[model samples]
Target chain A: MEKTLTLPSHITTEKLKDLYKQMWLIRYFDEKVDQFFAKGMIHGTTHLCVGQEASAAGAIAALQDKDKITSTHRGHGHCIAKGAETDRMMAELFGRETGYCKGKGGSMHIADLEKGNLGANGIVGGGIPLAVGAALTSKMKKEGYVVLCFFGDGASNEGSFHESLNLASVWDLPVVFVCENNQYGMSGPVKEMVNIENIAERAGSYGIPGKAVDGNDMVEIINTVYDAVENARSGNGPSLIEMKTYRWKGHSKSDAKKYRTREEEKEWREKDPIQRFKEVLIEEDILTEEQAKNLQEEAKQEIDDAVKFAENSPEPSTDTLLEDVYA
Target chain B: MREITYLEAVREAMSQEMRKNDDVFILGEDIGVYGGAFGVTRGMIEEFGPERIRNTPISEAAIAGGAVGAALTGMRPILELQFSDFITIAMDQIVNQAAKLRYMYGGKGSVPMVLRTPAGSGTGAAAQHSQSLEAWVAHIPGLKVVQPSTAYDAKGLLKAAIDDENPVIFYEHKLLYKTKGDVPEEQYSIPIGKADIKREGKDVTVVATSIMVHKALEAAEELEKEGIDVEVIDPRTLVPLDEETIVNSVKKTGRLIVVHEAVKRGGFGGEIASVIAESEAFDYLDSPIKRLGGLPIPIPYNPNLEKAAVPQVPDIIDAVKETVRFK
Candidate 1:
């Protein structure tokens, strides 16, 4: 393992271990979900962020409890990073009454408002404007909190992304846009889809600061997002930080991934964010190899328990189908 | 009681709400100093200041999405889309995000926002600027769609919409903005999902929405002189439609005619007609349920063409007369 590691003042050894554990949690959770989906246990399609865990973990870990985040469709990592319990999430995927959305939302729309997780949107660029609106509330009410908006590279090309960025910039709202630039957007390569090399560069159009970083590097993600969050908290305005990462899994359950080559997948898999973070933790003496194994075992056990809970949970009653449509 | 224009009534509702609640604010393109395209928000920026009465760019998606985000974070956002026709640009945010957030989140979160837009033709603003797309939003389960036809209904219903813990689409007809009606100076809120009987009769029932309400009333007057008594029912809100009032009215009159400014094809009139057909009112039919709506073409810029595209007083009068004369 490489020993060349520099830690920020806010990131202690314990925090590093916690983040490493969270990355593992996201990995185990999604991997289990993928397996369950194959067996027809989890209904509907799911977009897994198997290799892009660091971007969600690092960026979300930098914010306080009062801060909020709006996530994308492939947002299981974001939900976990923002403190959602795996059992409830699993129950939601199971279409049980105990699920986060009472079996109404399914996997695409899990949200925990009390945890500052506004919710994961099914639409590509749907959550962008909501983040700006949340920041607007923070600014108008003089609430000293910031909002971090998580979107995919594909969403950057959406009109909502441009409109949201412009509105956030003009209003000087406290928001940080974190774009997880996973190579492909539903099998469409980012390079072919966009004219620009970096999605972050588009932030300049709104007169806001933009940065692109190695999304696989957890330290780099935390540092970049921390600065952006502080900037927004202090009323300096919004910033767009594009995290260059890749998704190891296919876009959704039914994707054959015929659009990309196997060599490309192998290359990205080699740069797995969780594996890289675990190696760093061991090298920095934050986590020993034995402890790391135990952490992985604990995550597996938690997932097993979540599956049990989901199986035991009741299906949503027919009587409540019309409920929750209004307040 | 004081006579106020529908535009003034809307503005008053927002201003009063903002004054009463610190969390209430307004945002939209040209809504601040420009006072909006139809001047519904004129003189508002001065009263609430820029923070509360915000001016946004030409970004309807952001305006709507941002309002959802703000509303999620304990703020009541009143979003104005310059024109109802432009809702197409922000459909994903409004339909996919704002309309479904609460239900998708299992009732854990709510979007307490009001989307105000000017709808209907007669301004010669052409296809892009003039349209009555209320049916599109009313189709969504989680959204509350209101089309107030008078100054009194506009103020009261808007206040109720702003206070409701759900996303409300408030449709203000462009032609009705300058029309005056009696409104109380003191703040009041009309309950949503309630139908108002604009006029009472027994020979036939006329269910009209927005600008069509006036036309229906005028038609009722003209039909009265011809020995045809028409009962005009204004469905203030579309989603939680006052089915009982409409059903009872149809049951009493034994005749029904649904009218709206939107195209007759797939318009909200279909929903009203279905509601009547589904209820016990179906047994009390004197004639086939009649529906008068806009022609199934884009609104034309020519004054005469625009007038011809939608239902006018003569159309309503003719429909009522025919229904009453039916064996």
Candidate 2:
């Protein structure tokens, strides 16, 4: 086991506590999604980021209020980390009329414009170009806001990822390309699909700085992203940061987990980001057992209320179905 | 009013918009120093500087998706694809992201972006570079498709597309760049969905788009000497088709001939024909509706074959005669 690490000087106990709460909220929310799927409550399928909590919570903390993000299909954690209301998100997942997209878009298309979340894309590497465009806007308008684009390790193989990074580098756009290398894309293993060991190594092709980080290490991710965001804001250029993480759940509802063995899952499970951070907090005396338990209870209660709210919401009307197709 | 080439008109539209609003910027390959593939953006880099008149790498997906992201983040970005056929490389970003983001977000935000591409085959650029792909984008519900035939319409409609809240795909004809028309120097915008009656006659209504509009007009002139009166109508914008103007013209003329440069199968002409068939205009039609478009094949590299692939002025004349002759 790794020894307990001290928090960075810039990080306060209050911020870590908030980050802990957000991670718990994401964990509970994904657990509820699994439960809802088993009971056939959610209409369409969903991609869960259960074990990839620290990546979202830590990276988002480095961004400013005006900074924008483009999320992936498995993006509830990202949305929640960027400040989306869980009730609205739950309602959207339930296909209710009050949902983010009025039930038009399921979990894959949730968005929060006021919070600077562009939207989660259903296609792999779909949001990378959009993140670059947002960065272009910030640069042309002198908005002084950076853009954080999130994708999976599998998406790094997409032409969009390469093209977007190249454009961002050439134009010196204010963007951070964050690849959550969860070791798999659906059932395909990254080792087999890609020739390179580190996805970040490909960033050299675009003449941009690239680094691989321990996604489970909350403090390290925050510090790395914080510096990257600062560099982008100052018009330095874009950076590719590959965060090594894992997803405990199957790819989707239909996934049977036939690819990998339980040994591998167990090994990654022992490194659960939320649990690791919690252990650090306890070891450093930042949180007592009662305080940590109360945080878990608080997250569970919030998710419970969200589920009830979604269940109570009405379905969208047929007439309004065509309303939002155009401006 | 002063006469200017269609290329100049497009440049003026972007320049005027960029001057008036700092949020408006132009980006694409060779758009800055190289002045674009056709020199449409010549001298723009000098006026607006590299930041506003951005020259991106040869990455179509990034150009499109980046524009969408910029639009979402409060900047109005005008992205140019070097050629219309090249848009195939960026279908996911343009079709899946830019077109659906607003609708998928439940209309919470709009993508105020314009994608400008030179369409149609005249320079013998071959299969990969010469194409009229506007019909593919027009099929998307959330996108607004515009094809400006004249210099005046080019400037005015471009201004309108920029002001529009939805994503707009602006198709300029490569052959029409040198074609001159009177354009007003002051700022103005044409309503997006309105159709323009280019020429008025009693016998037949020839609805055309892009380069085909000029062909239809030339056909009308040729038929005039033979006492065969022909009316010409340019729908201008396809997605928000000016069904009323088209339907009314067909009602008065008793015949309809839709012409375009795209392949006949599943082209926008079919959409126009279907609109009339589904509307009250079907009852007033004295003759069968006709559609004249390119053959269902890729544009060839040879000048003769390319000319033979799509409609010429003579084809429009023959199509109009056949429509009027039909019982």
Candidate 3:
């Protein structure tokens, strides 16, 4: 934890506390989902972003409520950070009618448009261009809002990423491309996936500002994203911010993660974003140790209440399955 | 009523929509000052300016995905791909994002975007650029697919597509761009999923799409001289297909022929054939159903080969003759 860190002018102590709680909520929600999957209460596959919570929480905390975001498959953190209710998200994972997508979309497709989330995409690098489009709307309609596009290091190699960045730059669209470089894409390490030291270096190809940050540091993540978002809001065009982080879990429920060593996992766990943020909050006198513990318990209670709501939620009716296909 | 080229009709529709609605705008490669590859968006930039008529880099994925994002955030985006075949480069965005956003988001948000592309095999663009891939999008449940054969249908249907709440894949035939037909000057919209009975007769029903509609009508004229009356039906829209009109026409004619510019194998013709086969019209059929589409092989660059690739007017004539003479 950085003790001498200065918060952004717009970010209040209350907001920081809220962000810390959001990070915990994301952690507890995914951990419970992991338990549900292991117990066979949830079906299909889900990608968890346990150790990468700071990347989502910090970046989203920098955005306004009107600022939209396009998320990726491992998106629970992004959804929660964007102010989506855990009960609806949990019901969605449980395939209930009360879910975000009314049980239609599972873990990989939670969306809260009223909060400006454009939904989590199932395909790799799928949401990149969408962010550019949203920014185009902002510029064209004079909406004064920016779009924060999130993807992984693996997505940097996707043609969509290159194309979207080029489009956003050439058009000077109001968007910030946030690459959550979580070390590995599936089982392949970022080094093996691309021949680059930093994914942000590719932003130069599109003639845009690109920077890399310590993703585990919440203060750094928020500051970097806030700068990028302001640049876009002032009509300077898009910027690429690469947040170097790590996913504590496997790519999906079925991944054994044989590609990495136990030592590597232990190393990242030691740099836990939540614990680091909590320590920073306490050191800053924003909260006492007891208050920090209470926040963690509150997050656990929220997740437990979400699970109960999801369990009691009704299964989606077959009659309504055909609904919402159009319009 | 005024006679206009199909290309002009398309531009007129977009121009009218943009003029009436501030939220409506267009984006594509070479669409700003260059006025698009086919001049479909020519003069639009002058009226709407570069802010509204955006010229994007040659990035199909971003073009389509941007439209999805813009549409999701309360802007109506009319995205133009240089050629419909380039849609393959953007398939993931169109298929995964634009098509599924509304349904996957529990109908809380919608992608009111229209993806307009020039399709067909007449041009010397070869395999990469000359393809009628309407069936590819029509197969998706969350998308609305439309192919307009005449200037009237082109203008009206495009207006409807622009106003649509879901993603609409609007396929404009390359060969039909220069074709002239009567179009009303006032704003009008043709409802999607409604079949147009271009020509009425009692002998056989010719169900055609896009340029095939004109070929079917031409075939009907030739068949009329032979006393074999033909009913030409243009299914302007494919996904929310107007089964009632086709089924009723088949019942009256007792024969059916499905034609399209796409390949016969797994084409939308199969879907139309199934619709007729599963309906009460199957019992009234006096003969077996016939289907005519493009060759299985990729379209070639040579003019002769390109002409030979898809169903021409003569092909439709022969098919209608064969279908009428059946039994």
- Quote fnat for model 2: 0.90
Model 1 chain B worst lDDT run, 10 consecutive residues: B316-325
Q: Write the per-residue lDDT of candidate 3 for residues B185-297, one digit (tens) a residue.
A: 99999999899999999999999998888888888888789898889899889978999999999999999999998999999999989998999999999888999999999
Kindly report the interface RMSD of candidate 3, rounded to 1 decimal.
0.9
Could you give candidate 3's fraction of true interface contacts?
0.87
Name the 10 consecutive residues with the lowest summed lDDT in model 3 chain A: A1-10
The TM-scores, one per candidate, come to 0.97, 0.97, 0.97
Task: Report the C-alpha lDDT of model 2 over B1-327, residue by residue, as the tens digit.
Answer: 699999999999999988999888888889988999999999999999988888888888888888888888888889898988888988998899888887888888888889999988989889888889888999888999999999999999999999999899999999999999999998899999999999998999999998888999999999999899999999999979899999999999989999999999989999999999999989999899999999999999888998999999998888887887887
Q: Cα deviation of A235 in candidate 1 (Å)?
A: 1.1
Interface RMSD of each: 0.7, 0.9, 0.9
For candidate 1, list the clashing residue pairs, or say none: none
lDDT of 3: 0.90
Model 3, which residues run further than 4 Å from truth? A1-3
Ranking by lDDT: 2, 1, 3
TM-score of chain A of 3: 0.98
lDDT of 1 at B221: 88
Q: Write the per-residue lDDT of candidate 1 for residues A38-122, one digit (tens) a residue.
A: 9998889898989999999999888888999999999999999999999999999999999999999988999999899999999
What's the TM for chain B in candidate 1? 0.98
